[model samples]
Target: MVKYNLEPSESILIQSTGVCEGSGLMTAFTDELILTNMNIIHVSKGLFGNTKSVRKYPLNQVKIINGEAQASMGKSTNGIPNLQIYFTNGQLSFKFQSSAKKEIVKYVNGISKVLIGRESNLVANQFAIPGAEIVAETLKDTIGVFKGTLGIKSKGKAADEPVKATKKCIGCMSPLTGTKGQSIRCSYCDTDQIL
Candidate 1:
């Protein structure tokens, strides 16, 4: 596995056995194209065990703008597959001789997932229902006593408990007395905070 500059947890998502196109028409070179969570790594290994060139494109800096398979009647993996990527600082096109369009699309999407973090594709909006709240009496003393008797120092909660905050209706500014996150209906306003 050619990690290139990948972090310890990074793993290859896609790899293609293909030759890469050079700047000139007659220039082509064999390379292992690998896509990982952190980068796109292109490694060219020399005939012997010697000269090796590795080019890494960090996922944070690149975006896949286009990907398509060559419409060729020759063979499934014979024609060249293309993927166009726009680096935040620049742009480039990668042509693979031994790849297909769908494979390229899958790899492009993998890159996008790494860059954009997981997010829902569909769009939806829901508003919170109005509600009346009732905050309860302070329980810091009880909580402190409970923890001390158990000899427990719970994570995040300090040794000295903080005072509980009061709740109020945002719409009417009416003082509410209840526990945090509890759903309660405001009898005066007929508004409800649903679960």
Candidate 2:
């Protein structure tokens, strides 16, 4: 059995043993592939079984290619389907038992779902407007200042008195209430507000 450490939130989703075709001396060796929620672990044991090497690939960076068609094509020369996992730097091909085709397909589907969901979330977050609440508050405050300057009474408050100028804290961007040309310190971030 292969020994590996799983993370706190990681668990084995599926596993299978197959002959792995990797680069360099790691080629054509039978290794155990353990699929976890966060990563795919490849465990290869040395000839003596005393030495072993483990490699981990993040699930987000893994891509399953031509997995579904393997069932019909049987592309390998030995009449077996090869499960190809593509990474950013290289690729790994594994030849598993023909009976495990269903499990492999299921694994591919799960990976597809994860990748799609991750991509959508990234897009959503990337285009999201930052500091929207701050912008809205600033707009409201600007409108109030304009009203006070025009001597427009708001909510039964008298606008006859001079309105104190407001500036934003340099560090925290919080509104600072003070007179023009006065220096104030922000209570939130302790930043000096120079107006």
Candidate 3:
């Protein structure tokens, strides 16, 4: 039950305990990985449950390499999934139990989302296209006005010209029954055309 001191606006996203790979000559140790909105903290505890060391890696400075399937040219030594965080100066690798596969995947996904959001400055459904609807409505109204002024019908046969049954729809190539110079809307694809 280690207590964490988080900065303002920082929140913990995920926490897991696993075997952390050590550098050359150093033996592996059980470490607790705490992922937060701002950083990932690795806490190494002693036998008496006392914290021996703590390392913090800022989210912006690190790149996460997920399990073998997701990492490019990655391979698992013992079939157990590994999560590696690579930073500018060094890297950290942690191997978790097979049963924690789902949790590891979810944690990696969350981190990826955070990293993407930081890079793009946008999130899913964060903004609305209010102008899109207005633009569409205005275009519709303008088209209607133009059609009325120019004596253009969306779908009808010309009153003076003889019907040409050989004319086909440009969209679907289906035979159309309309006079030459008449604007017709295809029944199959609803495409507006002049036969």
Among these predictions, the greatest lDDT belongs to: 3
Model 2 clashing residue pairs (backbone): none
Sort by lDDT, best first: 3, 2, 1
lDDT of 3 by residue, 1-195 (tens): 468899999999888765454333343546677889888888887755678888788877764443111211112465445565566666666655444455455555556666764321111222347587789999988998899899987664544547565587888899888666778899899999887
> What does candidate 1's lDDT look like per residue over 101-156, in tens digits?
55556565666567655421211111112231222223655776798899988677
TM-score of each: 0.45, 0.45, 0.49
**What is candidate 2's CA lDDT for residue 30?**
58
Q: Tens-digit lDDT track for model 2 on 1-195?
A: 586789999888777765454333335445677778788787876655543678898876764344321111123555455556667666666655445455455555555555554222322333359988789999989999999899976764554444578877789888889766677889999887667
Candidate 2 lDDT at 126 equals 30
Highest-scoring model, TM-score: 3
Pick out the ten consecutive residues of candidate 3 with the lowest summed lDDT: 66-75
Error of 1 at 178 (Å): 43
Whole-model Cα lDDT of every candidate shown, in order: 0.56, 0.61, 0.63
Worst 10 residues of 1 by lDDT: 119-128
C-alpha-based local distance difference test score of model 3:
0.63
